[model samples]
Target: MSKFGFLKVAAAIPHVRIADCDYNARQITGLIRKGADRGARIILFPELSVTAYTCGDLIQQPTLLNAAEQALGYILSETSQLPVVGIVGMPITYGNALYNCAVVFAEGRIRGVVPKTYIPNYAEFYEARCFMSGEEIGFATIRMCGQETDFGRNILFNLDGVKFGVEICEDMWVPAAPSVNQAVDGAQVLFNLSASPEVIGKHNYLLSLVKSQSARTQSAYVYCSAGYGESSTDLVFAGNGIIVEGGQILQRSERFSLEEQLVVADIDTERLITSRRRTTTFAPHRPNERIIVEISLPKNPADTTLDRWIDPQPFVPGSPEEMEECGNEIVNIQTMGLAQRLEHTNCKKVVLGVSGGLDSTLALMIAVRTFDRLGLNRKGIIAVTMPGFGTSNRTYRNALALMRCLGVTSREISIRKACEQHFADIGLDPTTQSSAYENAQARERTQILMDLANLEGGLVLGTGDLSELALGWATYNGDQMSMYGLNASLPKTLIRVLMRWMAERCKDDAIRQILIDVVETPISPELLPTEEGKEFGQQTEKIIGPYELHDFFLYHFIHNGYSPAKILFVAQKAFNDRYDRGTILRWMRLFFQRFFSQQFKRSTMPDGPKVGIISLSPRGDWRMPSDANADTWMREIDRLIEEEK
Candidate 1:
C-alpha cells in the first residue's frame, strides 16, 4: 500500500509569544499539515508547544488555560482532515487539578490526554506550583471535543500497527523512567514532550540519556523539546529533537535553528517484538494498570517519501577527531581484556593457527600486542601453519612467512595425509566430499591446535569471528572450540578493514608486508579441495553474501531493533548503488535464518570481550534459547517480501 513498509514522524519547534493562543494555533496547524504532507504518521511537538512552556505562574490563570484548550480544539479541527497522529502540549484543569499534559489527536477527533507523572519543581523548572503530577495509576476520563477520553501514562495508543506510549520531559531524566515501565507493560514506542533548556555540555548528556533509555527499554523514543521560542530570559532552549531506537540515535535536529525544525523517523514494530521475544529479562508485565487504544493511521503506512538521509557509515564515528579517540579506546579495551585472561591462566605462550585471513590475522596481531604488554618473548607465541587438502600456496606461504617474520615459534604441518588417514579410519572415501569432508578437515585442524596447546602449555587462541558464530559457519568442536577467541567480538567486515589499518601503521616492515598480503587475500577456510586442481580455495563470500552487507544487516537487526521490513528499508537506502532491494531481502532472510539457527554455537562459546553494543557471547549481552524456533521470524520476512511484490 506504500512505497516502503515504514512511516515518517516529525518533531516541530515553533516560535510564538506566550498567552497568544491565536498565533500559536495557526502555527500548530501549519506544522501539522506540513508533517502530514511529508508522510508523517505521528508528529510530536515540544512540551507546552501549543501556547508556550515558559508561561510560569500564568499557567494557573483560568483564561490562559482555557485559551490553550480552545487553541487545541481549533488546531485539531483544521489538521484532523489529514491522517496524522499529533501530540500537542498544554496546561489543563480537570477535577480540582491543573496538569501539564500531552493531548492526543487522530482521525479527525481528540482521542486521549496523558498528564505528566513527575512535575519538576527544581532549579529552573517549577511545574509543581501550577500543575499536579498524574502519578496515581488509575483510569480517569476527561472532556475532549464534547466527549470523554482516557488519560494516564498507562494509556497506550496504537497507530501504524505499533503500540505507542507517552511520558513528559522530566519523567525521562529519572533513573527509572515512566517509559521503562510502559515498555515492560507492552509499549513499543515512547514519545516525550519536553521543554528542557540548553546548558554547556547538556546536548551530549541529553542525547546519551535518549540512547540509553531507548536501549534499556527496547523501544523507539521520539524526544521533542521546546526551542528558542520558549522564553530565554534566564536560560536558552535548543529544541533538542532526537529519534532513537535500541541504543543508536537515528535522527537529531539542528540545534539553535531559528526556523521551525522537524526531525522524523519510523519505529519498527517487528524489530521491537523480535528483540523482546529473545530477551527474557524484557518480560512483559501482566494485565495490570495498562490501557490499549487502537488509533487509526493512514492507509499508506509505508509511504516514506521523507527528506531523511541514511548515514552510510553508521558504526564509524561521524567526526575524524572522534573516530581516532574511539579507535584508541576500543583497542585498549580489547588488549586489556586479553591481557587479564592470559594473566589469570598464567599462560606463558599462546598457540594460534595462521590462515593469512582477517580473523586469524587480527587475533595474531592482538596476541603480539598482548605479549608486548606482558613483557613476554614473542617466541613464546607459537604461530602454526597447517596446510590442509584445500590449502593454496599463496595462503600457505603468507602464513609461514608471517610467523617467521614475527620471530614466533613456527611449525608447518601438512594435513593432507592426516585427513586421508582420518577418512580411512572413519570408513569413508576421501574423494566423497560433503559436510563431513569439510568438517573433518576443520576438526582435524582444531585437534592439532588443541594437542599442540596442551603439549606446549599454551592457550589456543581462536580466530573465528562474530559473523561466523552468528551464522554457525564453523564446524562444531572445530573452529567453534577454543580456549579464548580473541576476535570473537569483532565482526568480519570490521576486522578486514582493521587488519588493513594495522598493517599500514605497523613499525615492523616484515610484519607489515605479511599483514597487507593477508588483507588482499581472498577469504576462505581451505576446507574444500582447490577448484579442479587450480589455485585458491572456496570463497566464503561466494557462499555467504559480502561481510559488509552482513555486518550492516547484523547491526541493524541486533542493535537498532530494526524490523526485517525496516532492515530492508534502510539496507536499500544504504546499499542501493551496490545491492538491489531483492538482493538485500535475499541476504537479509539468510541473516535472520542463520542468526536464529546458530544460537547453539554461541551458547557454549569461548570467553571473549564485548567491544561493541552487540555481542554473541552467551554469558554476556545475549542469552537466547538454543532450541528456539525461527519460524515466526522467517514468517515475518516472507510476509514482507510477499507484500513487496
Candidate 2:
C-alpha cells in the first residue's frame, strides 16, 4: 500500500493450451513477473488456469491433476523473488474427493487454499459431476507441492496487514457467496477465479454483478477469467478481467484478445475502510471457523503517482448520455420537490429572484415547470429581477429576456433607494464596499421577496446552491432563508451543466440563447458597484477560488471523509494541468476555514431536498457543531504548504 492507502492489484488472463500444464505454467509465470514489474502487490489468474477449464473429463485423470500441481509448484518457484501475492486456480485432491481451489502463494511458499463452495449443474455447467462441494468442509490443513497450508472454503490470506479472500467461478454466482462472509470477517479485498463463457448480453450483466457485489461488500474486488486458447467447442471464452472498488469499475481488460492480458488498477482501500465504517448495517455476523495465513511479501518502493482517472468535476457526469440522464433526473427532482411543496401549501404562486445567473436561472426554470405541471397560469409564478448597485447591463437584459420568454410575471424591483435609505438610517456611508454595504443590499432584496410572497400568498424560492452554502457565501437570514430550497443540494458546477442541457432541449430559440449566455456569464453576487463598460464588478471564483476545485474538495472531504492532506494529493493529480500544488493548498486552506466558520449559517438553514450523496443539510446528512474548530485541519494543510516551500 502507498502512503495514501492505495493497493495496486492486477487481473491477468494468460494464454492457455488445454491439458498442457507446462505451457500454461510458463504463461502464468511471465504474466506474474510483468504484474510485479508494474508494482502490483496482488495478481489473480483464471479458474483452473494451470490446466484449462475446457479440459472437461480429462480433469478427472490423475495425470492431469498431478501435472496441475507441478505447474503451480513451478510458478511459485519462478516468481518467488517478486513482491506479489499470486492466486491461481487448479484441481486439488484430498480424502478421495477432488475440489476446485484457488491456491495462494508468495515468496516461494503456499500461504493458503480456498475451494469453490458452490458447484453449478445448470445449462453449460457440469462442475457437480467432477468436483465435490467444499461448503461443508470447515477448516483443514493439506499438503500441496511439498508444503502444508490451511485448506478449506473458509480460508483468508493476510499479506502484511491487509486480508483478502478468494472464491471460484460458481461460488460467486450463488445467492450465498463466500465473499459476503469474508467481508464480514474483516477482509478488505476479494478475488474470484472465473471461466464464465460469453453469451449474448452476458458481459454487461457480469459487469453489473461485479459492481454490485463490490458495493455490497464495500471491498475491492478483483476478477479474472479464461480468455483465448480455451477450447471453444460449444462455448466461447471472451477473456473478461475487471477490478472494481466500491461499485466503481477502475479498470477492465480487452476481451477476445489472442495475446495474454494484464489489467492493473489502484484500489483506494482507505476509502473502502471508511465506507464500511460509516455504513451502520455492515456489521459482523455469526462467527465462522476461518483460518488466516500470514504471508510476508518483500517490501517495494512507495508509489509517487496514481494510475487511475480522477474526475475533476465529480458532480458533473463524464459521458454525454449520462449527462443527459443525470441532468433530466436533477431537473425532475428539483421540479417535483417544488411541486410537492406548492401542493402541500395549496399555493399556485412562487416568488423567485432572477439575476441571469446559473442558480437563479435554474430555480426560475423549475418554478415555470412546476406551474405548468399544476396546470396553473405562468403569470402566477412571479420572477423578480431586483437590480442592485452592482447589476450589469448584460445580466439585466438577459434576466428580463428569459423571464419574458418563459412567460412568467416579470417584475423589476430596484433596491438602490431602499438600501440608500437604510444606509442613511444606520449612519453609514454607502460608498464604502464593506461587508455591511454588500450584505444590506442582499437583506433588502430578501425582505422585498418575503413581503411580496405574503401579498401574493406565494412561497419565496431560494437559489443558493451547495457550493455557496459550503463556503457560507450567503448572508444569514437573507438569501439563506426560504420556504423551500430546490437547489440546495445542487452545486455550482452542476448547475451550469444542467442549464446547458436545458438550453439544448428548449424549443424557444430566444430562451435557449439567453440560457446559453447565462451559463457563460461569470458567477457573482453582484453586491458591489459596477463601472461603465464592465460586465460585472465582482467574480465569485476570484474570491472563493474555483467552484470546480471546491466541489472536488467537498465530495472527497464530506462524502469520502478524506483528510485535507489526502484531498490535496488527489486534487493535485486531478487538476495537475490547471493548478499547481501551491495553489491547491492555498485554496484548500480557505475551504476548510470557511467550512468550519460557516456552520452557524447552515445550522439554521431552511428545509431543502437532498438530491445527491453529498449534502450539508444539518438536520439530515451533516450535523456539525456551529463552533467546530479548524485548527487540526489547518495544521495539516499548513505542513503541506511548508513542504512546498
lDDT of 2 by residue, 346-406 (tens): 9989998999889999999988888888899999989999999998888899999999898
Report the Cα lDDT for candidate 1.
0.82
- TM-scores of all predicted structures: 0.82, 0.98
Alpha-carbon runs more than 4 Å astray in model 2? none
Scored by TM-score, the top model is 2
Candidate 2 TM-score to native: 0.98
By summed lDDT, the worst window of 10 consecutive residues in model 1 runs over 300-309
Q: How much lDDT does candidate 2 score?
A: 0.90
Clash count per candidate? 0, 0
